[model samples]
Target: MDIKQRNQNAIDLTFQNVTVTVQTKQGKKLLLQDVSGICKSSQITAILGSSGAGKTTLLNVLTNRIQNSKKVQVNGKIQANSTEINFRKFSEFGAYVMQDDVLLETMTVRECLQFAANLKVQGDQHEKDKVVQETLKILKLERCQNTLIGGQFVKKGISGGERKRTSIGFELVTNPSVIILDEPTSGLDSFTAYLLISELKRYAINKEKTVVFTIHSPSSDIWQLFDRVMLLIEGQFIYQGKGNQSILNYFSNQGFNCPRLQNPADYLMSIMHQNNKNAQNYPIYFQKYDSLLKPYVEKEIEQGEKFEILSYKFETSFVYQIQQIAKRSLNNVKRNPILFRARIIQAIIMGLIVGLIYFKSEGRSQVVFFKLIVQILIYLSKDGSNHPTSIRDMNDRNGLLFFVCINQLMMSLKPCSVSFPSMRKVFIREDNSKLYSPYAYFFGRLIIEIIPQIISPILYGLIQFYMVGLNDRTVGNVFFYFLCLILNSLLGLSLGYIGGSIFSDVKTAVFMSPLIFVPNALFGGFFKNRKNLASWIRWIEYLFPIKYSFNAIAANEYENTHFIPSPTELLNLEFSKWECVYILLGFIIGLLTISCFCLVCNRKRQQ
Candidate 1:
C-alpha cells in the first residue's frame, strides 16, 4: 500500500562542529566533542553507539531540549535545509519521539492517536479521523487499536512494541517533515524490533520524511534497514557513510575484521574509537575516518540547507486545542478505574470515618467546679491560647466543625500532588511537541481535573455534615458548607500542583510535603488560636489556606446559633462569616495563579 501523504515538507538537517560541556562536581566535562553530521531527506539514518556515546545528547540538542545553563556550554551551528537555524525555530518543523513511552496508560491505542490527531491535525473531525486511521494502519497498530497503553507496574495493556508504535503514531498525525527518535527499538524482542524499524524505514522512503534515531544494538535485519549509519564512540563520530559493504571495508582496514558467522551489527558496535585513558586515540580515529568515510558525506555536507520555515503552520485554533486536551483528559479519567470509581469510594469511606467519630455534639453537666478546674489548668499552662472559649460544649462542637475543614483541605492536597508528577512529564512532552499552547494545556487540565476537585470534597462533606449534626442544618447553610469544601479542595489541588511542579521527582515532593503542611496545620487556628499565635508567626496563618477555610467553616456553623456553652467559650470569632468565605476564595484564586506559574516553570525546566 502507498502509505505516503503529500505536504511532507522535506528538510535536510546538518550540524557543524557541535560540542557540549557540562559542569560536574569533578569539573567541566565534555559531553559531545565537535560532532558534525548530515541527515538527508527520505533516508533512514541510524545513530549507532553503545552507552555514553552522545547519541541521545546530539538528538536532544537538535530538538531544543538541551538546557541553556551557564553550567552547561553548547557551541555549534545547526542548519535545516541548508539555512543556519537555532533549535527553537528548527523544532517547529520536526517531530521528536522521546525514548520513554510517555502515553497515558489508561487511554486505548486508538484514543491515544485520536487525541494526538485532534491537537495536531488541523482539520475537521472527518479529516482528523482519516489521519488517525491511516496512521494506525501505516504503523501496524490496528491489531492493538483498542488495547490500553499501560504503565510499568499497573494496569496491563499493549505490548512494548505497540506502545512504541503508538508513540510514533502520535507524531505521524501531525505529518511532520523531520522525525527524530531516541532508542525506538529499546526493550523490544528481535521480531518486534525489526517490524518497528521496518515501518520507520517505510515512512522515511515512502513519505519523504527525514528519519533519524539512536539505537544501542540492532539485529542484522534491523541494521540492513538503515540507509545511512553514523557510528559514535564517547562523543565523536567514527564513521559516516552508506549502511552497506563500504562500512565493512572501512572497518576491516582499521585492524577490525568481521568473521563470517558474526553479526555485522555486533562487529560494528565493537569498533570503538578510543577505549582507555592511556591510549587516547580519538585523533587517530578522526584521521582514519577522514581518509576513509569523510569523502562519502562531503558532497552531502557541502549542500547548503535552505529552510522554508513558513511551510510549517499551526492549523488548529487555540480553543480547539483546549477542547481536544480536555476531551482526552476526561477520557483518561474515565478509562482509569482507580481514578473513576476508587476515588469516589475513598471519599465515602473518609466521610463515614469523620461522621462516625464526631457523630454528635454532647455536653457535660458539671458547671462551677469544672470551670474552676479548667481555669487552673489554663493559668498553669505557659502556652495557653489567650482567646476565651465559647460555651465549653459549643467550643467542642465548633472544634469538630473546624476538623471538617482541616480534613477536607488535607484530603485535597494528596490528590493533585501525588498525581501531578506522574502526569507532568506527559504534559511537558506534549507541549514540547507543539501540540498546543502551554496556556491551553494549563486551562484544559484544570477544566478536566476540576470535576474531581468539586466532587470528592462535596461527597465527603455532605455525609460528614449531616451525620455529625452541626448547628447549621438548614439548606442554605449546607450549600455554603459545600461551597467551602469545593474552594478548600481547589486550594489543596493547587498546592499539590505547586509542590509537584516545583520538585522534579515524587520523593522530593513526598519528603517536602509534610514540612510545609505541618506548619499550616499548626497555625491553621484549630490547634492554636489565631489571636494568641506569636505576632511574627501569625503571618503564616494568613499564607496557609487552612486558616481561612477553618475560619469560614467555623463562622458559618457557629454564627447566630444558640448552643450549650454559647458560641465563644474560649475561641474568638472576629472575622464575619462572609469575610472568611471571601478570604478562602481569594486564597484559592491565589493558589491557582501560583500553581500555573509553577507549571510554566516546570515546562521551562523541561526545555
Candidate 2:
C-alpha cells in the first residue's frame, strides 16, 4: 500500500483493565493498576502525570512493550479497532518514537527518513523517496534536510528541536495508523516545545492518524493543544476527559480551582504532587472519577468496528537490508575517523619500535648490547648463511614471532571490544521497528570492520618482515608471513566482536579482555611447553586462537631451517604450517558465529 492508503487505515486504540506488577524482595509492587482508556482516531491524546505517576507504564502496557515474565506480570487486553490484538499485530499498525533520539549521527535528516522509507514504506526507490520528501515537508524540516543528526562526538549539525522533529519524521515516513511517543516534549525549550506540539496537532488533524503521547510540564498554550487529556497519579487515573473548559469545570466542582493568570497545567501538576496537601484529596477525586467518568470511557471503547489484524511484511529484501545498513556504517566511519586514524598511527609506531629492537638478531647472541662499534660491526657482518641457527637463535626467533602474534591480537581486539556495546541502544530501537534481522546487521557491520582489520596487519607485517630477518627473505616467505598476520588480526577482531556483543557496557568489556587474553597466552606454547601441561588442560590450548597463530608463523619461519636445534620440535608443536592456518580460519568463523549468537541473545533480552 502507498502512504495515502496506509494513513486511511487509521485505528482507534483501547486498553482495558491493564495492570503491571513487579515481584520485589518484599512483595509484588504495582506500577499500573486497572487503568482503562480509549484514544480515538484523528485526535491528540495526552497522558499527563508527575514523576512516579506511572504515565509511561500505562503507555508501555497499551503498546505491549513491557517485558512479561514470572517476576513481572502484565494483565491487560489491548484492542485495535475494537478487535483484541497481540503485540505483533499492534506493532504492525503502530510506530513508537522513543524519549531519546536514536538517529544515526552521521546521517542527514533526509537520509534518516529515506532509510526508514526503504525498510518500511511499500514501493520502489522513486515511491519511497516521494514519501520521504512528503514527511520532510510535513514535519517542517525542509530547511535542515541535509544537516547531520550529530551526537556527542560528531560535529554539530541540527539543533535539539530539529533532531526531535527528524525523529518524528522517521516514523511518519511509514504513514502508520497509530503513532505513540514517550515524552516527546522532554529536553526542549518552551518555545520549541510549543511549535512541536502545534505541528503534531496539525498532523493528527490532517492525516486522521491516532496520536498518543506522555508529557510533563506543558505550558498553558501547549496544554490547550490536546484534544483529550488523561491525568494519572500513583498509577491511577485522577481525570480523563476533554482538554478544554470541561476539565477545569470538573476540577472546580471538586473544590480545586485553577487560579486566574496561572497555567492550568502547572496548577494541575501542583495538585498531583504526592507531597502536596491537595494529594490528600486523591481518594475523593478517584471516587468521583469511578462514579462519573468510568462508564462513559468504557462505552466509547466498545463502539469501534472490528478490524482484521494483518501481519506486517518487510518491504525490503535481505540483501537490500545489508546494503542500507552498510551504507549507514560507512557514512559513520567516514565522519568519525578518529578511531581508524589512531589505529594506523599505533600500527606504524609499534611496528617501527618492534622491528628495530629485533633488528638482524638471527646470528648474534641474545645479549647483543647497544654499543656503537659492536653494533656497526654486526650490521656489516650480519648474514643468515654465515652462522648456523644455534639453540639460542631458535629461542630468540620464537620470542620475536610470539611477540608479533600477541601484538596483532591485542591491537585488533582492544578496539572492537567497545564497538557493539556502544551501538546496542541504536540497534535495539531499530530492531523493534523491524528494520532488519540480526543476521543482516551482523554481516553488514562485519563487512565494514574487516577493511581496517586487513589494512592494519598488512602495514605492521611489511614493516617487521625484512627487518626481523624472517625465513630467507624470499617473496614466498614474506607473503606467507603477511597472510598469517592478517588471519591472526581477524581472529582477534572476531574475539573482540564476541566480547562486545556479550556485554552492554564498554568499561566491563575492556576490563574483561585481559582476563580472557592472559589465560589464552599462557597456553599458546610460548610461556610453558604444551607437552608438560596436564592433558586435560592441554586441550584448552586447541581452543584459543593464539596457539594456532604463533604455531603457524613459527612453522613458516623454520620450514627449511639449518639450525642444530629445530624450533618446532623443541617447542613440541605438532601442527603443520598449513594445519595451523586452517585452524586460524576455523577460529575466526567460529568466533564470529558465537558473536552473532550473542547478538541474538541480546535481542531476546531486550524483548
lDDT of 2 by residue, 1-607 (tens): 7755554476888899999999999998998889898998789999998898998788777777887898999998888877887666766778888888888888889999998899888878899999999889888899999988888778788998899999989888887778999889888899889988888888888877889999999988998899999999888998998997889999999898999889999999988888858677889979999998999888888875455534556557889889988988888889888888888888888888887887777564232223423433444322344233677777777888898898899998988988888888888877877778888998888898888989999888766655666664344555788899899889879999989999878899898888767877888899999989998777888778799888898888877666766677888878988999888888899999999999888874222
Task: Report the alpha-carbon TM-score of model 1 versus the true structure.
Answer: 0.88
Query: Which runs in model 2 stand beyond 4 Å of their true positions?
Result: 1-8, 309-312, 364-388, 604-607
lDDT of 1 by residue, 208-309 (tens): 788999998899888788899998877877889789676877777876678878878887676562367413656676788777666656667887345454
| TM-score for each of the candidates | 0.88, 0.93
Top TM-score model? 2
Q: Rate the local accuracy (lDDT) of all candidates.
A: 0.75, 0.82
Give one clash count per candidate, in the order shown.
16, 0
Q: What is the C-alpha RMSD of each candidate to the true structure, in Å?
A: 7.4, 4.4
| RMSD from true fold, candidate 2 | 4.4
Candidate 1 stretches with Cα past 4 Å from truth are: 1-8, 152-154, 253-255, 273-283, 291-299, 304-307, 340-342, 363-390, 562-570, 604-607
